[model samples]
Target: MNPQSADAGDRTTGRYKQKREAILNAAARLFDENGIKGTMLSEVAQQVGLSTNSITYYFKKKEDLVFECLMHTTSTISAIAAESAAGATPEERVTRFVTGRWKKLAEAAEGQYPAMMSFRDVGELDASYTKTIFSAYGDMFRRVRGLLAQGPVTSDNRMSLTIRTHLLLTSTQWTRTWLSNFSVTDYGRLAAYMCDVLINGLLAPGKPWAPTALDEKVAAIKLPEPSNRNFIAAAISLLNEVGYNGASIDRISARLSVTKGSFYHHIPSKDDLFAECVSRTLAVVEGMQAAAIAGEGSGGDKLAALARSLVGFHFSPRGPLLRMTAWTELSNLEQFYGQVQPMRQLTQTVVDFLATGMMDGSVRPTHQAIAAWMVVGAINGSATLDKWVPGSEKTDAVELYLKPFFCGICSE
Candidate 1:
């Protein structure tokens, strides 16, 4: 071939590679912001200045692009977990993992890396794509769990490791939700603070985790609006299983063995449906908090009661509490319901509990807000108890699940 022809071919290849990375970057960001079910490939194409048809040159279909994007995200996290494995101690490993991950997040915030993903819709993909995604996630889960393994591999430690691994992962992931509140420079400090909460826990020494029963019991939740409570429950079930977009009108109606007309009759729109699900979640959380606060107990009592009740509620008929990933759609839900930021209120309520505990000598003097985020993260992750653990029915969530966060994950 002539030199000029070869040189032109090389230039074309380089440009193609650049655009492909650009597409992946843009798609990842869109997926994170709008969710996998919510983002359109054409939107990704538009973000990268390519025509939708032009995108097909790189990815023949939207799922191809989504699979690649998810794979790219999985690889990024696996690499971090691998590196974090080098720490000599479990706490050090935990600290390094959180710090390194956030540094990448700092970079992502500064456009240095693809936006870190929320694995909420890993199940939303088709069987062919999800098999690979779930496998990658499983490996990553093991790697993080390895960070917590101290010695002999007993079922007890296995339980703790499994529980703590999810706790650590979800809490760190939850950081992306609230961490934006801080500057990129503050991420490292915040990561350290998070590690402290995970390792040392929130309980002040000598303060037993004696969560008293609620003074005034919360009535079973009837949501969206009172008149359409059953319909809202079905909708919440679908939202928890699928997602906002995946919870189609068809599925909601079918879950209740009703017609689409019924869904529309009971629920006005999908946006309203999401608002109702979120509203129900906040109501449950706030109900527990209010009951806890009204009782005469240390901060520890209020928090323990709140955490245990919320987690157990998932197993209850009204359960599953709107999944933490639902918070990503906060802005849209807020618009639908007007300016009541239920998520912010949720975090602040935990902060109030932690602060109260610290004052009353029931909880340690830690970074109250960050510690609250850990609680939020751990509890959010634990809500998947039925799915993640075998015989989640038999599992004492307060002991096996909640203990890691309430008492230190590493404590004896």
Candidate 2:
């Protein structure tokens, strides 16, 4: 009741807030690395020098913590999109929005702010929090979509703008995967180059989006198809939906209308199931790559073919390749290291393909490694296409989805 006592209470409250923020920061980084389902409250507490019970004082449960983290990220992004809407034109709005985001990203990477988590794992959160998170996310998405519209929406241009909205946002999110390769100071340049790519596209002027077919080579790849009534087939679909940790043996078995014994009979363990899924996903990815390279076409044509194959496969009945984020759930450092090597090698393969395009003058002369990674991110991030463009799974992937990447977002 005394003035000194009130002053002391203020100091304690400030410290509590600081400590709570510290936990949130640590939890966000862990969620970025290991996903929400894979992160632990104890790990977060350990990062902040607090006991697990102490964390409960701030957040009642893991979902509460995760929901707050996700809401923070969505709100931050929505603010960016809203600020960018001040630009005079759609293209200006896009450039301003993207550059603003990258600057913040650079600041965060250099410890200017707490790290932000991606929405890739938001679908895996507890049911109680999903509705609110989805509402926030939908608001954020509509604001981004606002940047691409200046006139009344029509049936013809609605889908085009919707897909572009997804592509632009997904490409921004994809930066998290490749932004570490450069010095933080270089992010400004990277952001400009990315805007250039999105606005002008990778192809040299006047190039068309014609792609060589990958069907024959894809058929010869001899991997499990998505439409099949098999274990791996059902597992891949389930993994794509709920993420790695959320895709349990029971869920997979029940999806296939089988028993847990049958799951054990076909797959030895959960890790083994994930390993097999990863192996198959890489196979399909590599097979598509090889198919594109082997096709009769220019470098740009091959790149188009590759992008179409990967994106189309995802949105098609043959698709839904294990969402690449699922690969991050392998906690065993040994298995993680061993399994990730091929994927790393595959990324280099994409760089090489981009180099080939540049050499033949089919593609523009830009940063190859960055371009390669962007293409990879574009494909991997398309798993959310259904949410962005309702009924996107049944649409022509090349036209509505991959076109904006191959041709500029501002293309006619």
Q: Pick by lDDT: which candidate is best?
A: 2
For every candidate, C-alpha RMSD to the true structure in Å: 4.7, 4.2
lDDT of each: 0.74, 0.77
**Which 10 successive residues of model 2 have the least lDDT summed?**
1-10
Over 4 Å off in model 2, which ranges? Answer: 1-16, 213-229
- For model 2, residues 318-375, the per-residue Cα lDDT tens digits are 6667776666655774666776676777677778777988999889988888888888
Error of 1 at 333 (Å): 3.0
Clashes of each: 0, 0
Q: Summarize candidate 1's per-residue lDDT along 238-335 as a digit string, tens digits.
A: 77666777778888888889888867887888777777776777777767767666766777777777777888776666666777675464445546
Q: Residue 296's C-alpha lDDT in candidate 2?
A: 72
